[model samples]
Target: MALPQKKQQKSDATAARLSALNLPEGGAWAREARGAAKARVEAMGLPHPRDEYWKYTRPETLVAPQAPKAATFAPYESAVFGDIDRVNLVFVDGVFDPARSDDPAIGGVEIEPLAGVAAKDIHWARDLYGVLEARGQAPVERPLAALNTAYATEGVVIRVTGKAAKPVNLSYLQEALDTDVMIHNLVKVEAGADLTLLENGPAAGRLSKVLEVEVADGGAFHHVRTQGRAHERRAATHIFARLGKESTFKSFTLTVNGALTRNEAVIEFTGDDAVAHVAGACLGDGKDFHHDDTVFITHDAVNCESRQVFKKVLRNGAVGVFQGKILVTPVAQKTDGYQISQSLLLDEDSQFLAKPELEIYADDVACSHGSTSGAIDEEGLFYLRSRGVPKAEATDLMVIAFVAEALEEIEDPVIAADVLSRLEGWLHRRRNG
Candidate 1:
């Protein structure tokens, strides 16, 4: 059956807009993946505001080939998490800049460019380039991810064979206006290996990013990221992972402000006893701005555990969105999963939308999910104001307390503290205003 006349016209419009960019040309594996994704994008078309998933946030900025104007933020005197010891790889204007990055000579891990690897003999990445992405298309339509698979030309490809001495950091720098960038990364932690990844920076005026990971049996991977403070930038990013027996994967993201952003994560437990946790904390503070987090977790093995926790602070008509789901297959017995998404609306014009779901087929599984949106606690506000804390100070304090619950998911005390300071800075500025 063909799509309705209106829908077919919409798809043709989006595909025509995207045809201006150059697609990937590589080895058999990569070429095949790109071709498949291109076909999918044409069939599905770029997401439109009328689309169910994009009803709240318009997709005009994302699907259009022309980059929207975005003001570049002044470089911070001290970068976030600068004190953390790690090997850094830098990308500028969507291209690798070796001059501004640390040499990729970390011990116990092999770091190579994805483009380079795709041109060489068969390797582990051959099986993963877009494998997880293709799998993620089900249960949801992600046209942006498919666009990434077809056009993203470069990024770090890391393979950890043993415990890494330090984390691997990806530092992205914005250099020009309308600089469109697409980055796709692949990470593989071998059996029993441990790896930590840290990424930060405003990638480009228009950015599309994808991170793919495979955690082998008993391996562990930890990820912490801070989205760049380019307040005017727009981005769409996706993360896809598959876990083996007893493997562990945890990720946390801190987003301050942006004109537009949409982040999606998809994970599947392919082996028994695997564990996965995904969390995010975002602050949307101005008008005509939007932020979204969409997550899907699947449990195919028995005795696995998974968690999704998210919190957002929206004010001044800023809009925030969260959609998360956990699925347990019939054979995935003894599964333990939990999900929560909440928000604090600072004013009458702010909005927070959430959809949390659970699909369990296993009789022995334990699953729960909840979502809530509300204003500052009147009681708590009075308690502090009564003690001479002043209304502005008191309100800022409450905002801190509200967002703290989700920050606990970071696990790294140092990173968490940095995130808190940034959150406080935002609140402090608002209070003083």
Candidate 2:
């Protein structure tokens, strides 16, 4: 059978991209996992502008054979989450840096670099490395995630057996402008255990990262991520999570500035009474800035609850996009799902695009979704101005209030405050300029 011209072109581009990279070598299980991921990427090819989901954002820079040059930005403030006490794992140019990292001997948790674990004959990651990613390919194709699984240069595998006293932080630093990073991380929470993961950094000039998390019954997993303030950086990140009965999964992301960013989250509730929440807040400025958040939540068990909340503030022709969906199966009676994506456009030149969907097979389930893009509330702005607040300061204050709802999704109050302060700093700098 003859293939469509566009499809053939995409496949050819995928081949060319794969030929440019040197796949890492590992043990039999690792090899098998990578091989399967490689096949999946080949079959799906790469994303194109014509694709339904890709229509809002262009994938040329991410899929090109050569990475687009990105100059690192020197920020006015220190690193995020620096004040918090955490076990830090540093990565420079996609490779783990032990000298800059704390010892991986945290209590109640086992952490090992993916490179070392992949070389072993048998490990717990063998069952999780690419399993969730493979399963997330249904209803939509994520070729970038498959590519990361096939050629990831570095990452970590974490198994939490009991409640962790402190959080584990993954800090990425980009020392080279042309570095292209591929990282795949795995997290497993055993029954009745809990873990929190913190991620912050400007990974590289170009980055593709995949995180697979599995939570057992009565377990909890919390993740807070901050994409760095690299104005020229480009990144594609995917999170695949499966929650067991009576488990909890919560994730929040704060993106300050980037030339391009696409964040995707696929979550499934496999056990009754499970809870999952995904949220993000982004601030974009300038004509080249672009951000996208795509989330899909599936309710396969009874009495499960899920929520998706995302907010973006754009100005100076920056663009924002959101695509979210909630699915309820016949068995998922008494399910509750809520989704909201809103954008505050500071200028008429900026634009926000959103696609919200809900598909339910259960009559007893309650699912609702809403997307809105508008300017700052005129009454609120006027009230602040009437109180003798400067226009710039009043706008900034309103912006903070607009995004506070999404920030509330953070489970840790201290972490939430830190994020709030960072957002303030970004706005302060912009106002001063």
Candidate 3:
């Protein structure tokens, strides 16, 4: 076995750069939890532009402490799950608002605000806070998440003992301008339990958030999130999950518009016969919009199944990036993994960059990944135009069709329809603008 190496010397320059952000401390947090997370961030300095992981997207804007000036735009009417029935919890500018949110207890699920039990000696979240974030550090570094752990203002912790009667919704209202928000959330689904999480709206003008989840044996966790319509907002978010025997975890995200947004997900399958899937659909239009998705999934047990599907629509000088990977450990025999990332560019100026990787140590594992980028299908566009459809309308329909393939991965019919409506609104605005 390889012995762990000693910590290296920290550069003064790197230390100075990190210090500028005025990272948060563990004032009300558990002492041990706070110390360990702070230590991790101290050891893993911020990623520099020259770093391989940050070469595609610049990190300076994300690491900075100040919320850079951003223009706020009107939100779409009753966006994301407007027609679905669910219990809602609202967070405005990263602070939980009870008056605007729903009750904590719903059916068999119990929800608690992290701020309420933050410094308490006894709490269910003591073991989960920063636990998954630390575990996900291997093979790749997540400095931003570490920073979030070291200093985050607020978030919610949810525990599901039995099947939830209704989906729990997180409605983020970004009403304040130039707001810098950081949050960490924890979720646990006990054995034989089931829960669904719905998230929507722009969290803030500048937001850094993390969610840690544990799905016990036979537990199921489903999540669907649609980022807000604020074209000038900036966000960096992470979702970490661990699955036990026979458990299932599925998450899908639809990103309509943002000035600069980067979302990262890290998932680990620890028990045999577990299943996991993560998918995203992002549409970026106009010069200032940029969207990036970075995902990593690890199979550490036998008979585990995992999948990744991502699609991006870019036009009018918009930029998109997708970095995804799947890894199977030596003992993870008979693992099944699939990954695909595709992009559609409407014009010559739009751009999409992708890096898809699969690393398998087990010989019996089945894994495949592919990436493709191209303009709209000319044949389909011609056929639509031949039907007396306007050229612009025909192009928009083809673009929508391209993204529909990825949207179909969403299982919930109502949530899928909500996403479709948002997509239609975005396409309409893009055409008019």
User: By lDDT, who's the top model here?
Assistant: 2
Tens-place lDDT per residue, model 2, 25-101, is: 99888999999999999999989787888999999999998999888776532679999989999998889999999
Error at 228, model 3, angstroms: 0.8
Residue runs of model 3 more than 4 Å from their true location after superposition: 1-29, 75-77
Q: In model 2, how large is the Cα lDDT of residue 190?
A: 97
Tens-digit lDDT string for candidate 1 (63-151): 88787988777664246777788888888878988898888887879999887877765667878888888888887888889888888
For candidate 3, write residues 320-406 as lDDT tens digits: 999999989999999999998999987899989999988889999889888999999999999999999988888889988988867
lDDT of 3: 0.84
State each model's C-alpha RMSD to the native.
2.0, 1.5, 3.7
How would you order the candidates by TM-score, starting with the best? 2, 1, 3
- Residue 184 displacement in candidate 1 (angstroms): 0.4
Best by TM-score: 2
Alpha carbon deviation, residue 197, candidate 2 (Å): 0.4
Ranking by lDDT: 2, 1, 3
Judging by TM-score, tell me the better candidate of 1 and 3.
Answer: 1
* Clash list (residue pairs), candidate 1: none
